[model samples]
Target: MSDVVYTTTHRVVVPFYVYAGLAFLVATGMLFTGAAEFSGHYFQPHILAITHTMALGWGTMIILGASHQLLPVLMEGELYSVKLAYLSYTFTGIGIALLVWAFYIFHMGWPAKCGALLINAGVIAFFVNVVMSIVKSKKENIQAIFMLTAAGWLAFTTLAGGLLICNFTENILPDGSLHYLSLHAHIGIVGWFLLLVMGVGSRLIPMFLISKYDSPKILWSIYGLINGGLITFIFIFLREAVSVLYMIPVLCVTGGIVLFGFFCRKAYRQRIRRQVDEEMKISLLAVVMMVLPLVFLIAVIVTLMTISADVHMVLAYGFTIFFGWLTAIILGMTFKTLPFIIWNRVYHARAGTGATPVPKELFSSRLFNIMAVCFIIGFISFVAGIVISNGIAMKVGALLLLLCAFLYNANVFKLLFHKDRML
Candidate 1:
C-alpha cells in the first residue's frame, strides 16, 4: 500500500493534532513548575500530573488520531465508523482534563474516578471501532495487527490506571500501589506506546525511505516477543515473584527492541531514497533514543541487584521513554504526517490544475529546527539534573522545553490553519 491515507475526516483528525500540541505545551509547563518535584520521589502529585499530560494528552492522543486515519489505509478500506472516532475524542478530552486537574491537586476523589472511567469508556469505544474496521476489511496485515493489540493494551492500561486511582482511597489491590505501579506503567509504555511505535514505525520509516524491505515473518516474531514479555510480566507480578524474575520479561522485550533496530537498520541500508531530510533524520534518531530508556532500565536493574533501587534512576528511565524516545519520534513524525494531511485537505480537489504549495510549505522548518534544539538541550539538562539532584539544571531544561513546546504549537497551528497559495 502507498503511504497516503485520506479516509478519516479532517475534523476528526485535526482536533487530535491540535489537542496533542497544546498538551505538549501544558506538560512542559507543568514540568517547569514542578521541576523541584524531580529531586524527590517519582510519585509526587505534580509529577503524576505531568506524566499523564505527556502520556495521555501528548502521546496517546496523537497515536489515536493517526491510527484512525492509518487503519483503513493499512487494511485498504474505509474506517468503519467516523462517529465512534468523534466519540472517542470527546470522552478522552474530558477525561484527560479532569484527570490532570485532579492529579495536580492530589485529589483522589470522585473527579479522578470519573475521569478514569471516562477515559476507559473512550478507549473502549476506540477499540470497538478498530476491531470492527479490521473485521469488515477481512484483510490482515501484521502492521494492522500491531495496532489492534496496542488498542487492547490501551484499554487495559486505562482500566489499570483507574483502579490505581481508586486504590488511593480504597483497598482494592492486594499489593501496594508501588508494586502495581510498575506493572501499570509498563503496560502503557511498552504495550501501548512502544508496541504501536514499533509497528507503525516499521511500516512508515521504510515507506518514507522508499525501501523494498518487507518481512512479515520477522514482524510477527517481534510482535510475539513484545507481547510474550508483557504477558510474562503480568504473570510474575500476579505471583509476586522475586525482583530478579522481572528481568525475564525485560530481556524478552529488550530482544524485541534489538530486532526492531535491526529491522530499521536493514530498511535504512536498502533505502531507495538516499537524500534523507532533516525530519527523517530526527525520526532515525528516535531509534537511538530508545537506548536512553534501556540504559536507565539497566541502571535500575543493577541497583536493585546491588543495593536499593534509586528513585532518581527510576525517574530517569520513565522520562527518557516519554520525553526522550516518544517525544522525539512524535516531533519528527508530526512533520512527516501532519503536512501531508493538511496538504491533502487543501489541494485534494485542486490537484494538477495549477501550481500548488507542497506539504512542507504548511509549516516552518526554521521553527522545527529551533524546537529540536530546545528539546535536545532541555532533555539533557533535565535528565542530568535528575541524576545529580540539581534543581537549577532541571529548571533550565524545563524552561527550554517550554520554549520548544511553544514552537511546536506554533508550527502545528500554522499547518492546521494553512491557506492555499500557489507558487
Candidate 2:
C-alpha cells in the first residue's frame, strides 16, 4: 500500500474516535439497563433515555470523531482548526450529558430543552467547519463529497431533533411531537449514518480487503438513489397525504438497497483475502439485517391500508434498525477499525522490530465470536419481546446486550492499555 498523501500532523482527531468509542460502550450499557426497565412494563423516560443515549451519545459521537479524522485525508488539506474541533466535542459532550440526565432523571423540561439547544449549536458549529473546509479544499474526493452531503443531513437531523425536544416541553407541533419522529430518525439514519457508511465503506472495504475492482459508478448510484428517495419521501410525506406518498420513498429506498447489495457482492467476490476475520463474517449479518425493517415497513404500509399499527409495532421496527442492524454493523466494524487505529497510531512506527505485533494478532477472535452470538440471540429475543410484550424475554435480551457491551469495552481497553499488540 502507498502512503496516503493527505495526512497531516494532527493526531488529535484520533483521540476523538477513542473517546467516541468509549462513549458508545457506556451508552450501549445504559441502553441494556434501560431496556430492562422497559420490560418491566414501559416507561417513557426510560425509553427516551436509552434511545438518545445510544443514538446521540454512541452513534453521533463516533461519527463526529471519525469525520474529523477523515476530513483532512479526504479534502487534501488540514482541518480548518483543531481548536474548533475540540470546542465542538466539548459542547456536544456537555449537551449529551445534560440531555441524558434530564431524560432519565428529570423528564423533558427546561434542562432537556437547554441541552438540546447546546447540542444543536455544537452540531451546527461542526457542520460549518466541515462544510467550509470542504469548499476551500484544493481537490474533491469521494469521501469528502459524501461527508459534505451527510453533514447537511446531520444539520437537518439535529434541527428536527431540537424542534422535537421543544415540542416535548411546549407542544410546537399541531399533531403532537412524535408525528415527525420517523422522518427525523430515518433522515439521520439513512442520510447521515447509512450514506456515510456506504461512502466510506466503498473506499475502505476495498483497501482493507486488498481488491482492485473499483466501481465508482455503483457508489454514485447508491448515493443518488438513497438521497433522491429521501428527498421525494420527505416532499410527499410532508404534504399530509400519507397514502400514496409513503410508497414513493419506500420504493426508492429499496432500489438504493439493491444497488448497494450488488456492489457489496461484487466487492466480496473480488476480495483477494479469501478468508477474512470473524468481524468481517459477522458484519455480513448486519448487511442482511438491513432488509428486516424494509420488509416490516412494507407490511406496515399494507397494514395501515386496513388499520394502522400501534406504537408497539412501530417500536419493534425502530429497535430492529437501531440495535439489530446499525448496532451490529458498528460493533463488527469497530473490531476492525479500532484495531487498525491502535496499530497505526501506536505500533506502526515499531514494525519489523521484535517488539511490535501484527494487527491481525490483536485479540481473541473466539471471544469476539462468542459475544457476537450472544448479541444476535439477545437482539432476536428483544425484538420478539417487543412484539409480544413479553417482559421475561425483554429482560433476557437486555442482559445479553449488556454483556456484549461490557465485552466490547474490555477488548477495546485491552488494546489501548496493552499497546504491544496490534489492537
Candidate 3:
C-alpha cells in the first residue's frame, strides 16, 4: 500500500496559519496591556476586536483550511472543486478583514453587513463543495457523515450570524438585537466549532495512534444530542415559546458530553501502542478541560435562578468557555497537527529512502511539557482573576499565556527549521 499523501487544495491554508500566529500575538498583547478594560468603556472595542480576530481570523480560518484538506480523505473522493476552496478562502479572508476593521472603527452599517454577507457566502461555498463531493464518493464513512451533519450546523451558524449583523446595524427583530446576538454566538460555538472539531477528533485521534476502536455508535449519539439540544434551544430561547424549554438544551448538551467521554475512554483502552505521544497526553488533558465549563455553566444557571446574572459573572463565563475549553483543545491539537502537516509537505517524500530522518527526532518533548504547564498556570490564573476582579492577576496570567504561546510556536518552528539537520 502507498503512503497517504496529504496535499492542501488551497495555498491559503499556510497563510491562515501565519495569520493565526499573529492573532495569538494580538490577543496576548491585549491581555498584557490590560486592553480588556478600556478607559471608561464597559464594552471595550479593543477586547471585542481581539476576541473576534482570534475566533474568526484564526480559529475558523484554520478549521476551514483543514476541512478542505480532510474532506477528500474522509469521503474517499477527490475534492469536487479546488477552485471553490480558493474562492471560499478569498471571500472569508476579505470578510474577516472587514469585520475586524468595522470593530475597531465602530462601523456597524454597510461595512458590517457586507462583511457578514461575504462570510456567509464563503461558508455556503464550502458546504456546497463538501456536500457535493461526499454525495459522489464510493465510500460512506461515519466520519464523513458527521462532517456533513456538521456542515448543516455551519449553515445555521452563518445564518444566525448574518441576522446578528443585521440586528447590529438596524432593528429588524421583535425581541431585541442583543437576544439574537447571544443566540448567534452560542450556535456558532456549540453547533459549528465545538461539534465539528469533536467529530473530526473522533476519527483522527484513534487513527493517528493506530487504534482499531470504532466510535460510530458514540458519534451518532453525540450527533443526535447536540443537534437536538440546539434545536430545542433555538425554539425555546429565540422564539420565546416556553421558559422551561431551556432545560432541554442543557440536558442534551450534558448527554453529548457523556457520550464523548465514553468515546475517549474507549479509544484510550483500544490504542495498539500502549505508550502514547506527548500530543495524545495533551489532548487527553483537553478532554478533561471540557468539564471545567460545565461546572461554571451549572453555576451560572443557579445564579440566574437566585438573582439577576452579574456582568462580571457573565465575563467569567465567557472567559472560561473560550479560554479554558477552546484554547486548551486548540493548543494541544496545534502541536500534534502542525507537525504532521509539516512532515507530510516537507519531509514525507524523503523519508524511508535515505533522504530524511523521522519527524519525531525534530522536537524537544521537555520543552513542550514546560510550555503546557505554563499555559495551564496562565489559563487558570486568568480565569481566577476574572472571578476575583483582580486586574494585576489577569495581567500576569496574560504574560504567562504569551510565554506559552511563544514556546509552542518555537517548538513547531524548530521542527520545520531542523528537519534536514536531524536527518
Q: Of the candidates numbered 1 and 2, which has the greater TM-score value? A: 1
- Tens digits of lDDT, candidate 3, 1-423: 335553563354555555566666666666667634722223556666666776777677767777877787787668888778888888888887787777767788888788888988888888999889888877778777777777778788777777866877576777555666557767877787778777888887787677898867779899889888888888777577544456678889888987887888888898899988877777777777777766766666666666755556666656666666666666677666666666666765566777665556667788888888888898888878777777777877888888877876778667556544443
- TM-scores for the candidates: 0.97, 0.90, 0.90
Whole-model Cα lDDT per candidate? Answer: 0.91, 0.75, 0.73
Candidate 1 per-residue lDDT over residues 1-423, each given as its tens digit? 555543787788889989999999999999998899999999888999999999999999999999987888888888989899999999998999999999999898998999999999889989999999999986779999999999999999999999999998997988666668988999999899999999999999998899999888889989999999999989988897877888998899988989899999999999998999878888999988888898889789778877788999999999998889899999999999999889888888888776788787789999999999999999999999999999999999999999999999999998988888866
State residue 191's C-alpha deviation in candidate 2, in Å: 1.5
Q: For candidate 2, lDDT tens digit of each residue in 187-293?
A: 88889877877777676666666678777777788888889989987887688776656888888888888777777777788999988777876666777788888
Q: Is candidate 1 or candidate 3 better by lDDT?
A: 1
Which consecutive 10 residues in model 3 have the weakest lDDT in total?
A: 35-44
Which pairs in model 2 have colliding backbones?
none
